[model samples]
Target: MRQLIFFGWNFIFNADVSPLRHIPDTKRRHLVLQALGLMWAVSFGIALGSYTVLAISVLGHAVLIAAAAVTVATYTAAASKPHLFMSGLGRSRDGEHD
Candidate 1:
């Protein structure tokens, strides 16, 4: 809990707060990967014209279904990964850091 507040203050006050200073490099990489996955999910959801339509309609529809599945899976996985959560965000994981 304290760490979250500290992270935000550091962002405002300290220029030396290296982005990777708080988390391990490995975890930082995972965080970037997860963030990119989330962005991709948004793009896919936006570009795919009709959401209610099932993927069985056309051959290319399978791509939409696959993308949706990936997005859901990434969301699920992110829920378990604490580094993926922004510290200053209202949704702090409490003891759920992983």
Candidate 2:
């Protein structure tokens, strides 16, 4: 069971970042980068649709744009400056807690 868990984790979280070691902060940066890209895409789609097929009201479109902007900005900052997401618990980004 433990091995299964470890394998799953490595497959999902450590697959790309393996060569860099399991730095949690670095992993977080990767995740945030992905999220930033996703949100940016979503925002683009919504903005485009708002101009054509989507029937969303002006206020709804504005709110969606605002949320997307916030998400992109937050994740971009986190991914760009990894230290901001550090655990700072005197331990590596591994599961061990010191």
Candidate 3:
């Protein structure tokens, strides 16, 4: 248990696998945006399930679902192609630093 806790803490604070280091610059932004979209989708599903099971506040559940949807949409769009609004947000493809 102690070792597991230490490993978790280290992983959280000092991650060894940096996406920038592991993934090529061309695909790094796409990968990050895709991951963000996936996370939002997961959150949406979890919130829906929780509301169904716990019968919690409908307003809160709706808000969570809406937020997740919007976030996922934005991330998906950003991942699909480069846009003026999201300029300077992702890694450069012209051998430029982010």
Instruction: Identify the leading candidate in terms of TM-score.
Output: 3
Model 1 segments more than 4 A misplaced: 1-24, 50-98
Residue 52 of model 3, lDDT score: 83
Candidate 3, RMSD to the unseen true structure? 28.2
Tell how far residue 15 is off in model 2, in angstroms: 18
**Total backbone collisions, model 2:** 0
Q: Tell me each candidate's TM-score.
A: 0.26, 0.30, 0.32
Candidate 2 clashes between residue pairs 3 or more apart in a chain or in different chains = none
Relative to the true structure, how large is the alpha-carbon lDDT of every model? Answer: 0.68, 0.72, 0.70
Q: How accurate locally is residue 85 in candidate 1, as Cα lDDT from 0 to 100?
A: 53
Ranking by TM-score: 3, 2, 1
Order the candidates by lDDT, highest first — what do you get?
A: 2, 3, 1
- Give the lDDT of residue 27 in candidate 2: 62
Candidate 2 per-residue lDDT over residues 1-98, each given as its tens digit: 99989877676556364433454576676876678669989999998987765555766788999999999988998889877667563667568663
Error of 1 at 50 (Å): 6.9
Give the Å shift of residue 20 in candidate 3. 12
Per-candidate RMSD vs. true structure?
29.2, 30.3, 28.2
Clash totals for all candidate models = 0, 0, 0
Model 1 pairs in collision: none
